[model samples]
Target chain A: MLAKEIIKKIKDAESNITSVIFVGCGASKADLYPAKYFLEENSTKIRTSLYTANEFNYATPKAVNSNCIVITASLGGTTPETVQATSKAKSLGAYVITLTHKKDSPITKDADYVIVHGFEKSYAEKLEKMIYALQLAVEILNQFEGYANYEEMINGFNNIYDLIEKSAATVLPQAKEFANSYKDENVIYLMSSGATHKVAYSTSICLLMEMQWMNSGSFHDGEFFHGPFEIVDKDVPFILFMNEGKTRPMDSRALTFLKRFGAKTTVIDAKDFGITSVISEKVADYFSPMLISGIFRVYAEQLAIARNHPLTKRRYMWKLEY
Target chain B: MLAKEIIKKIKDAESNITSVIFVGCGASKADLYPAKYFLEENSTKIRTSLYTANEFNYATPKAVNSNCIVITASLGGTTPETVQATSKAKSLGAYVITLTHKKDSPITKDADYVIVHGFEKSYAEKLEKMIYALQLAVEILNQFEGYANYEEMINGFNNIYDLIEKSAATVLPQAKEFANSYKDENVIYLMSSGATHKVAYSTSICLLMEMQWMNSGSFHDGEFFHGPFEIVDKDVPFILFMNEGKTRPMDSRALTFLKRFGAKTTVIDAKDFGITSVISEKVADYFSPMLISGIFRVYAEQLAIARNHPLTKRRYMWKLEY
Candidate 1:
């Protein structure tokens, strides 16, 4: 089912929803973050929480109940912990919505609504999970309490994919340069703030560490001055995502420090890609992740190519009992 | 003011707090996670949110209002972002509580209640900030809805310092061994589950990276298999905190995988320190962080000694305007 249809069904059947919980694992979990951030940023009436699927299952929040909506995703819908979490949420009387690339997968078995997203079709399709999750958040707020910029948000969503494609093309040269310059680096640290923080996190763990087997980590741009900034030096490699949002100053502050320290840095700024040209400035932050996620995929792909490592290359994932 | 006194004042003056917001920066922000986790784990009535101090100041959550309690901290109470965040929360009509080691710091200016925590006096003193935060969480839940194990929680608090001393002594040999074995490692990855997850995070960013200038990262044990495990190969160093909580299985599962792959690991088990002998099994998870935080200081100190790096060593913190 489409995200709109699922939300309409929930709105028709439920009138007292008080919480929204997003649960998944790894990149799927990271994909759910924009939606969670959006909901928390826009709505004051509902509580928002995000958790890894296994943690949600093992140490479930007390807030997961009859008035909660649990939105979970797994790319193939076969992650055991996620499937179990979906079943657990359903058992606890949550309105469960599961997103996956495949239909009739185990995660969908217990979900009240199953959204079969696309990953192998096109640039826009690759972001189906994140887009749908954001749509769910936007529509929920619009239906429940009436968002002030509801029309602007919907328009941003409409133009985001095309903007992403254009942005990706614009950054290809820089992405290739990033791949070559940092090819031999042992560790690369990423930083960002606001809505795109998880984009930095997923790119660090999934793309760098998992795909390229390079040591990588991500920190909130606001958090850099606290502890992580102590590691910045003349030759340390950093990939910073500069947001075009309220927290953009945090990114700029960190960038200033990194520059002063003479750190080797590659910055992907949303503003530079003309994000505001397609997305309204009022609701641009909510759509930054889609552009950042889409553009970073190009960067990750280039890095994989430069390192002669296939993005599918994995040392232990799905190859062993673990 | 003592944490109990602060709670008493709040109990007398305010009866409509619907949310709790924890804000700080770096290790300070990481220290607040246990209390946030405990509240979410135990209470359904109170919404809990945590943010880096700057983020809270810049893009304040709409929930921060007269119906909210904002708990913020800084060690010497001089972190500009945290001080500003405290001021912002107070302006938003939140009942602001600020915790710090120093008296009359900038952060204390706008706070309704100020808690002067100890950091230099004793082993338990080192954890005063975390202890007070946890106490606040426990008291809030008990005052609002009557926690089932409130007595157990209070007893645990009373006995925690002594238990931490004993646990530190018991782990001394292992800590020294860990320092020696890992003295030359460039990067060390830490992992844990439940409340102590932030312990690993603090150890990574503050202790290892900030103090020693080593490359380090931490991840949830529940999240290790998803992406981080791919970086685990023979001789890769890891420090795993094994909890005595409901999420203990998650740690054990990751440990099993780490062992199978021959990753060099140091495991810190709260059960081994006899936490349940003093704290009840039901409330042990919330207190695991206190024990872990206190005990791991010994490990960090030993590592500093082995690496010929003092814990006070810093490149830029307080040395420059970043």
Candidate 2:
């Protein structure tokens, strides 16, 4: 499904959008930028709502007269919502784009632009592709242009990936103890911000998709308020990030706050942040700490696999609107 | 925080409301669609959470004024979440628009459209901003012409929001059960679909931000079934969607299945769905679910107040240049 035209369309349509809409389901909701954040970042008018194609007949956003842009991302391109919304948007006169694993699907033809995600050979590949496609979509509002921070992001990703691999070799031997760490574990919270926010997103995806498949939540240091902050206590196990480049005091305060809740909070950061005598070195905040996220994913994935759950979650399946 | 030109800008930006609607801790999230189904059917982008200002900052969509269609809401221009995200988007050439309590705040200048959610001031003023701002936004997209759906949505919001005057209301009263049902509760799950998806978003927010002031998780039935399904068997309290839409099947499967695990499941929907409902009908599957989402805030807020915590959390607030 990978195509240069999709990337070009992303580059072209990002600026032309007076308003933008996103249609998808499942992890896509959490993985995509918060509408408020994405729209505010892109200068495009944006709104995000979870749509079910079956409900497309209901009154929805008018895409008439070339007023806005509507985009779709579905591995199958057959999600009822994606299909119906594209049809509706087209009828309303809005420009449309499709991001999917199967480009030959009907959705691709209906869309004004189709971005195909590569690596959909299997469920794992499809899941990763789902992430990649949206990342590509979200990052399209790139500030640097021409893959500005892409190289940096790749470097960061590789660094984290390597560290995680090495760490998993050593720490995963304690899989039983790691599994025993939370005897009464009620829930797992993934807290991240700044550079690690996207890392947290990836971490969270791995988390929900793999180990501790217990319900998980991902939020920045700032979002814990407005309501969810009230639930943090000893019963919940939290995975929080400490980024000096992000919110230092709050990250620290969050550690303290989570501590008061009695959550066995595992701080994700460079080993130096751990008050040890060694393992301290300087690396870009975005790159180094990301390794911790990757490590956590590795550990969690191992734990989940030991427990026998597919990283792509095949234990049980769900049926969408056929 | 209120300004005239900003309001004028909002009216002008209505044409840009093709697909995006901005939501946050304040008025931004308060916007209501005529039906939950409508919003669910149309949305293509999703963004918002806390602020670096609110902890939700930077966790949004990209912005480019002419290119990005956008919506923003905040009762107080000073809210960290909206301000920072809005400012960042402005830097990206976003047409910053807002539903705010003031005119002079940073949002008006950055936004192309500014809708004045001019109303009585209170912590709840945020509700007005969210609902009306969203209504105006989606109304601007009305294909019905003469804004029929827009007017219906506005009326629907008023119908629901005003219900707040009654203490016995579904959402408010059910919220009163928080202590009885959730206090000391180890794990809680918020399940939903369609526009009500954010209903769980609010629930997850409360769990993490209020009770033990801890971490929380949100899951859809399909995702929960994929792998996380096994966790629903015990010790988990869940809130599921029993809305009048296609979401019912999966949610029902979750409800029926999760009940076997001893997880407390609350279904939010009309009476037809039974006490199994999660939030309530006033807040349903379409975009206007935010109306019920508004009440959910008060529900959680009242719980927080009753818990005798600080009531207003001021931990991670940020300072911005705007």
Candidate 3:
């Protein structure tokens, strides 16, 4: 849950504020894209932007405003760039809302309002926590705009979480097969649209490529047709994250193209997981990516095992300074 | 150069306008990111967004308004989604500005103002045209706000075009060496920040991966460390697009990390091309990526040739129907 101070701050600034900036580093930064998608789809009154912590630190005072709400998320609460960005946003007269696992980390020091989500030992666990934090912000903003019932939405997330956990059993077998089929292939592509855009990004960059040391190219489905589709052929393996939302048609078009080309394609459709059956149909589209992330992590884990690499293995991440 | 009617239309609505939406399909869609970056870096008065054509068509009246200007770029101007998006923007009462190669194209028919830049036979040439169109819009808006000298900027761009062309000779040898070294490898990484961010994306997806059929991963410099950095090793090759701007320090940090780790890194810096010497210092930062795009295209072509492939070759681009 968000801090009481944060809700009160949003309530106070709701009318004047025209923008919300989500700032973070690494996986934390990718998490902002979905939050951005959520806020953009829900609130037409507020503009949402995703910025990496370092970019925010440099672009501040010009990119942010006194009439803006800046949100930062760091699982460790100690990322130097994020810490600096939060301070910069505060100095620029913007409201700062920070989400971290610890109350006393460096990022918390300069945050105007801090929500401590506690820690997770694994990447997937940390990702889930970050998603919840973003989902909470979406609820708060929607409530502030008088567009939705915040309390009901929060309760609905609990049900959606349970449903996501339940979908793992159904997703695991297919994920295992996919991993077994494509494990030896050095390069793969992942495509998605709308809310699941960042999920595809993180799954490729963070989970598969980084954690497992597999190579990948991930793209938004709408942009898939322009040129990247040329790389897709019968021998190329790809994954399509299809969500039940306005962007579904775009993904469907790409999927049809991929299938028609006889490319080895994996489809992770939210509807297959019965997302609407668990969450209210009204809110299913908003929550699709969060649910998909939970379901997809199983695939990443399976892929890592199939590739014979531990997810914790790293060459330059924690092993080297650069 | 932008047509007069477009300038007059923007000047007329400049007082009421609060947002500008850049819409396109594929490479056209990715091109909007740089334009969005330019507007954000220069003008803080208006909100800017990059939307794919399909998404814009669906977002419709909710995402656009009379107070918004929608800009779409399509080289041939027959992209079905882009044409529909332009029409949809008109229907939603948003001022529509379309960039295409012909005045009578489908997109131009629905657009309030259309600027035809003539047909480009290659991706690089088309990219140059799109960048110029976006730069022209940036100048027009900044001039309308009385924050910049439009005519001087336009004249300066002429000098920049010559400088970028001059840099091609210097970049080719290294590009040829890079292509030879990595042509056999399936995957590569590209990293950049700020204005050059989209250049990295388009270069990876549109040029190397799509045209040459090489696999690549591209990340914003600020975002490279989150998780993707774990994939880097002495054996893994990466290209870093370093620009001379506010976001330079961000790229420098990543470059330091990259070099220290002994990863094979190619640094394509704006300064290396004598950008400041050719372009006015006042406008050099905004012109960095455009320069990079021009300089980088030579490498893409060289790489394509070295890999024994033609840039125009595609498996399904225009060869098949989805």
Best by lDDT: 1
Off by over 4 Å in 1: none
What's the distance in Å from true for residue A229, model 1?
0.8
| lDDT by residue (tens digit), candidate 3, A1-322 | 5544566656676557767788988677777677676676556566667888888787552547777788898878988889999998888878888888887999988888887763454433545655665565665566566555465566656676566667765777888998899899878888888878888898888887778877787888888888788887776889888988677888889888888878889888898878767667655666777777778878877988898898888876655544
Backbone clash count, each prediction separately: 0, 117, 1
The fnat scores of all predictions, in order, read 0.66, 0.43, 0.63
lDDT of 3 by residue, B74-133 (tens): 878999889999998888888888888777989898898877764355434545655655
Candidate 2 - chain A - TM: 0.63
Query: What order do candidates take by lDDT, descending?
Result: 1, 3, 2
Docking class of 3: medium
After TM-score superposition, what is the CA distance of residue B173 in candidate 1 from its true location, in Å? 1.8
TM-score for candidate 1: 0.98
Query: Which residue segments of model 3 deviate by more than 4 Å?
Result: A1-5, A13-15, A118-130, A136-140, A143-145, A148-155, B1-5, B118-128, B136-155
CA shift at A71, candidate 3, in angstroms? Answer: 0.4
Candidate 3 chain A lowest-lDDT run of ten: A118-127
The docking quality of candidate 2, as DockQ, is 0.28
Worst 10 residues of 1 chain A by lDDT: A1-10
Where model 2 places Cα greater than 4 Å from the true spot, the runs are A1-131, A134-180, A194-216, A231-236, A241-263, A270-294, A305-322, B1-23, B26-129, B139-148, B161-184, B207-216, B220-223, B241-263, B271-322
Highest TM-score, which number?
A: 1
TM-score of each: 0.98, 0.64, 0.92
* Candidate RMSDs in order: 1.4, 8.0, 2.8
Query: After superposing the true interface residues, what Cα RMSD does each candidate give?
Result: 1.1, 6.6, 2.2
